[model samples]
Target chain A: MTVQDSLLAPDLPFPIFQISQTVRRYLLYDINTVTWLRRTHNILGVFIGSLPQSPQQNVFFGLPMELQPEEATLLVEKGLAFIADDFRTHKQAVRSPPRAMANYKATARKEALATAKAVTKQKQLKTQEVLQRLNVRQGTPDADNTVDNDEPDESIFDTSTQETSSRPVSSSVIPYSSTPTTSYPPIPTPSKQSSLPLPEVSASSYALFKHLHALGYFMSPGLRFGCQFSVYPGDPLRFHSHFLAMGHDWDEEIDILDLIGGGRLGTGVKKGWLIGGAVKNSDDNEKHVATSEDGQSEIGRKPGDFHVRTFCVEWSGM
Target chain B: MGDLQPSALTAYIEASRPVGVLPQDSHHHALAAQVLHNLQYQHDWTDLRIHTDSSHSARPLLKPLVSGLPPHRIYVHPDEQIEMLKQSVQEKDVPSEREWVLPTHLRETWSLRKFAELFDGIDPVPPAENQASEEKPPFPTAKGGIGSRRGGKRLMLATVGDDSTVVYYVVHDGIVKPRQN
Candidate 1:
């Protein structure tokens, strides 16, 4: 699946909003965009939203998928998404015209009033049915006559009548719309001054991420697994991660103990410990030049910028 | 085997055992002390002290916390960074503040509520000096002085693996602005 086949409009790149800069939180709140990214691109960013049903429990989560920096960078590079500064867009959205706000309020009020009326009618019908049933149980020959009789049980009818009468005719009960209101203008393209470039990731780590991503593996932040990335063969929902991947500079010294610890940990969890880096080559100088030229102007790196080499380690249990 | 001696860490842990706590709680005290030991010797931290009670109410803390001044500032709040950038002040020039360190075992599972409770028990910033420990010399105040506008409450989470490897992460009380790379 490609960008053209996305559920979202073909022309619009999925917007990955930078929710926070200090802790580097990139979030996607739009359900459609999240679904498209998951189904089409196999990008299963972690859902960090609190589940409404069980707000206290952390076993399950809801919405606002949090993407790792590598995932965000990859999506931007592939032209599948763009980073937007959420604070700026939100400020712009709140400044919508008063006319639009009034129009939305009117529509919302109308809908609420209709719902209130329907609920009252339904309640009245239920009361009538119950009254008729009570009369039948009392062996009344004419249930309808019993209901119409003024001497019949007035308590139930009185309460029902009072409830219907007390029901608010206006839609003041609803303080806000349950659905997202269309009154706010669409998020505008951020001005250059406020625009956010793609999230920055280490060159070697990004290279490793790009390499693994191209192989159709789904990856997530590996803080829990004590590695740079935990890679799964399919959606995390359906499969366990198969590897704990760490990225290092090509010429950087490898600590033997770190390799052993990673391997042992991975083996304990039935996964491979993988290490990799971008191999330095003559094209590296050109890449540096390209990076310098694009500095602060480009949102993502060009494809095929780095040649990555990877090794997977599994403990022999000797 | 007969000539073997107890290591300094073991001896220190024995000597510093917290009083009037459950036997299991001693394990946590040991963990905090171990982290403190690592920070002082391995990491060259100064004015290290183990906190058994809340700084605010004097109630016993959920777990012992270690307070120390690191050789360098472990975190720079995004807003603080922006302020420094505007003032053209280099980050290194900023005085390092004493930090709260929550020590945990690598095997333990943590939740947001637990973290929030921990944050509530502590102050926004650790006390400037270790007032509880008298033997240790007071940390010398930096020449420029610590900034007045200290950011929100934060702590350094130190997870100690079985192999004696301690990994530290800076955790703030709530969502903070992201720092530039």
Candidate 2:
């Protein structure tokens, strides 16, 4: 059923707005689409028999003409796309569950709890056995000739301590496996580091900070306190070279602009395929140079002349 | 609810682990925070906060607001749409650019009551002060404008995972006139 169909349906148990509002709530905030699908069967006008395997390329609601089921699936797809595209365009990337993440926590929690209980029981049984062995009386010291209990006592202590230490360590290892493996890796060594050009402003530039702040845009205090930049000295621009690996071509300069502040001008920091604003030398009297090689500026001004700043920043990840 | 806990977001950041903006200064956070970092670094957005609590849960979605100037034309009233349509009847050169919304990652569910609550706390327009640095030249009027002017719309660039799968949205407090798509 298409969203339109559902709106037109006679069998709707709830008010259309109630259902629509519920659907909107799920679309706007639901993290798990599959769970949303299963729980809110009536959210879409038509129900999807099963989720399409390829979500990225799959089209929903392509044509309006179809049976109720097909139309409903398409409508659901449209709703999903509407939400997804809206989110993508606005950059409000909400966390949706990947197929793997779906219901993983619930099952994982169950397994973890089960394993923990079993481990506790196992440990308790082992400790009890040890105690039983230790407390076992060999013929109760009455009738038969008694061997020195101290001799066996020393061996028992050594064996029990060894068993106790080994059991705990092994038990701890089980819990580690129960935790989900992290996706992010730790920081690499310093030698593997490639330097990114830091933006540096002179002590005099501190005055600009106040003006910017008063204007309702603030630099991160960390950036203000410690931001560094590459100085070009007398020349307004500097050229640095690095060898390209694999697909990168030589002489490719990409500029990334600061679109939110600094007059919304491009910063002089561009990586490969990553374009930004070029820092305009306010002092450069030479006919204002355009940012691009072809001299085309998106904003119709020389990119270099758009914003006046002291330094430029650029970096490459690979 | 948001007003009751104005400092909630700040406290969340304080308590959570710090993930550096640059890739090199690696740090650990929950899967959600890492996604939030991608939105911030790539989009140059601010106020990328997420609420992790499970109360009033809706679906698993991230709610974050972008802090910057209005990207393209943010708000289009329904009346304005008609006006633009009439104006375009004569002008042929004007090409409409859909607003570029920044991505944000929110990690909790929200109910209608909560959504209404969030809308209540937010302004009809985006907060001006926390706006991202723009690459475009400031309009002459903006140059002289002083203290806390309209920065633009609230753009939230939210990331769903470790790899960059971002969704952007422009949220409004109440109904506004719709623009011609």
Candidate 3:
């Protein structure tokens, strides 16, 4: 395959795990794979995980990245990704050897101990420097050497001293017996037989997403913007979204007031309001239903089965 | 009937007489009253009441919240739905729970802190009324009364636009499993 073909359909497809069935949440947890998806396939999922650096603050988030159903469906259709039921995989992991779990705990405890020791050493050094400065100010620099010699070795491991320090140790530094909720042990790749069928999205919305994606626009969920999807000309990290897109069926009624509201809102934010849908006649609709009834998955259907038409609306000063 | 008269809405708001609301924040009570009126009349919700004090802290809430029973259940947690399906429970057979409604203007800007504060003030389920003897149990007893464990604390965020159109979105206290489309 040429480079362009590889971009559309990679030889080794990535796995998108279906964590929840009801809400149809597809998440990709591996950061390296997330970067690869963006660079190679132009797929940009939202990071919905809390940041470890500042878990209390909501301004910045971390992984696992959440993919729109349309994005997951498109990736599966293109032979670039597959969906697996993570809950099933998790159940399987629970049945694995207890020795593996013990090993994981041991490693975590060792890491935590090292971190705590490092923090204590750093604090002790800071305290020694402060004492030396005070000795110099008193014109008794010799006392600094005595103070250093008098430093108690037991104080390094003393819990009371650490607790009485001006800066209390953060909870993150203390090792707890319970495993962290966020971390998971590595599991074997799920077999093809265990892979789930791609998620089902509204036909019109999928068509609109595929059309915009084909034209090189990256999209993200537009719930924050009060729209279906936010369209970006380049990677969202490097560029602002250019449009707030809404999809409809070809014969669906268009509310003029809703259109005006969308246009005005989009213009106020320097974005255009985009509306689009797949044009399907009655015959095509019947054929689609017939094919589904014949036990053919949506992936077996062709993208060229319908043509999508899109229009961009912006408020005019006049 | 004709469009609801502004004078009637004003009279209803006055009659509600929401207490413990600060003078400057009286507009919030009016907003909650407007939503309560809509829920009771337009939506056919029953057992409607406006709350000015926090159920947990007993302190005045950031704003008034309207609690009522809708004609039908507005939301069913995905996990709860699966459990009900396994038990072969009919959709109509599942008793409806009272919903907490947070009323606000569409033009208002909301932040995560504001939402967090609101969620902190309320209980997972709104308190049941003492006078309603005819009301059915909130949940079937066979399921061990899964009250709020499966579906965390949530509220109906009612944002009223300038056109008097109230749009509601389910706002949960924390991450809840997504429901299938």
Candidate 4:
């Protein structure tokens, strides 16, 4: 791909993978790839992982560069990079290993305990029936064996019903399989389990990023510059950053000190400070359902493309 | 779940070799690690070298000195700032420049005396861009360009907050003329 091409080279888009949590990594093939990113795009992600630099070993593991979720998500949406599995998709997939493992382990433990309890109770009842049948057979010397088998099954069904009634609703639906739970460790409810449900920082930050990228402004996490994002009016190599952008939500309260601090920093760097939030529409139910998927589609279109309203804050020093 | 990171900042520092023997104190090392991490990633610095040997002077630095070359020049000497200002007035584009970055954390406060000591050890301009930078004074006492850069022996003060927000301020060793608005 021609590096000098004015339009973004669609072919050169990097591949970003969400490794764990806030960390995401991009596998870079060579040192020159880093040099190109550093000098051209102004994409200054850190080298979080590397192999020993030696010529003797033909196996040179590519350098792994790291960026925050805010940075990673933007790179993907802008078509500057494509993620392995979008964070949003991975997040909602209950099958993802980490959370799934924990959830499964706890569920398996609870089911096992309930099954053990029911099995012991059922076995005791079985022994009692067997003993009574033995006594009856001894007394009658010819009680029909088929009738005895039939009688015990009805009683076994009654005992199973009792077990179902006593066990938790989660464990009671399947009747016949007394399958032992796998040897999975017990998992406590995750920290997020009890917290109120809301699309968090990742979602909102992504919303802001999507809005800006659509506007054609290249942006990166403002962490280095003390804001939520830094908006570049043009390719970073050609122009200084134009704005220090901060993102919040409609209902979230912002600190005045933050405004003043952001404004002062903007003034110092000769850039405008932008504070923004995703506009809350009147339809609460639609928004509630769309919150997660809202990031992907623009069909839930409000009056304007700017679902987020950004206002400039420039400090006027007295 | 999104916020948690194995936090490879420390290990990255070790691999980058910002310097060996980071700090005896865990807190100091951690603070140094954070700044170095940001410098490498956020600022796009290369060849980061950390200094923990307090043996540079009497009264060891409150923390370590992190030096690296930012992808772009971050500071302007008084003379260079003046040259750029003059060029801009003359209708010419000011040339791009690069500076060696001295990374610092946000929580640490510094007095003038402390700053002067830091000024003592390092060159006013980083050694990386020596061809264009060598002639410039290591530290100039004159007033700098109009509200552009701080004067005197200056260093880029990179203060990283707990939320990983880093703000850079150009600090001078002593008073200089405040630029006219």
lDDT of 2 by residue, A1-318 (tens): 678545444321111110122223112222133223323331222222223465564444221111122212223333332211222322221243344444565667667867876776676577657655654665365434245543554465557444554465443434324754432122111121221111222322332232222222212222221221111111212232110001111112211122112111112221111111223233431322333222234363333223311111112010
Q: Pull out the clashing pairs in model 1.
A: A21-B178, A21-B179, A22-B177, A22-B178, A22-B179
- Per-residue lDDT tens digits of candidate 4, residues A1-318? 464643433244544544434433334323454556554555555564434466454332345555555555545544465554334433544444686677765676677667766776676576667756765665475566545554554465567654554454444344443344322133221222222211124555666766666656767668778887788866766877777777666556554445557767776787766655565653532432354222445565555444554455443221
Where does candidate 3 chain B have its weakest 10-residue lDDT segment? B172-181
lDDT (tens digit, per residue) of candidate 4 on B30-69: 5566776787787777666555544344545556666666
* Candidate 4 ranges with C-alpha deviation above 4 Å: A1-14, A21-63, A74-82, A85-201, A282-306, B1-181
Which candidate would rank higher by TM-score, 1 or 2? Answer: 1
Task: Place model 4 in a CAPRI quality band.
Answer: incorrect
How many clashes show up in model 3?
A: 5
Q: lDDT tens digits, residues A149-239, model 3? A: 4354335445655553546555446654444555556455555568898798998789889877876789999998889999987899898
What are the RMSDs of all candidates, in order? 23.2, 30.8, 25.0, 25.6
Clashing pairs in 4: B18-B50, B73-B98, B73-B99, B106-B160
TM-score of 2: 0.22
Give the candidate order by descending TM-score. 1, 3, 4, 2
- The candidate scoring highest on lDDT is 3
Q: Cα deviation of A234 in candidate 2 (Å)?
A: 68
Each candidate's lDDT (Cα)? Answer: 0.69, 0.31, 0.70, 0.52
What ranges in model 1 sit over 4 Å off? A1-10, A52-54, A139-152, A157-194, A281-304, B1-181
Indicate the residue-level lDDT of A195 in model 3. Answer: 83
lDDT of 3 at A4: 65
Best by DockQ: 4
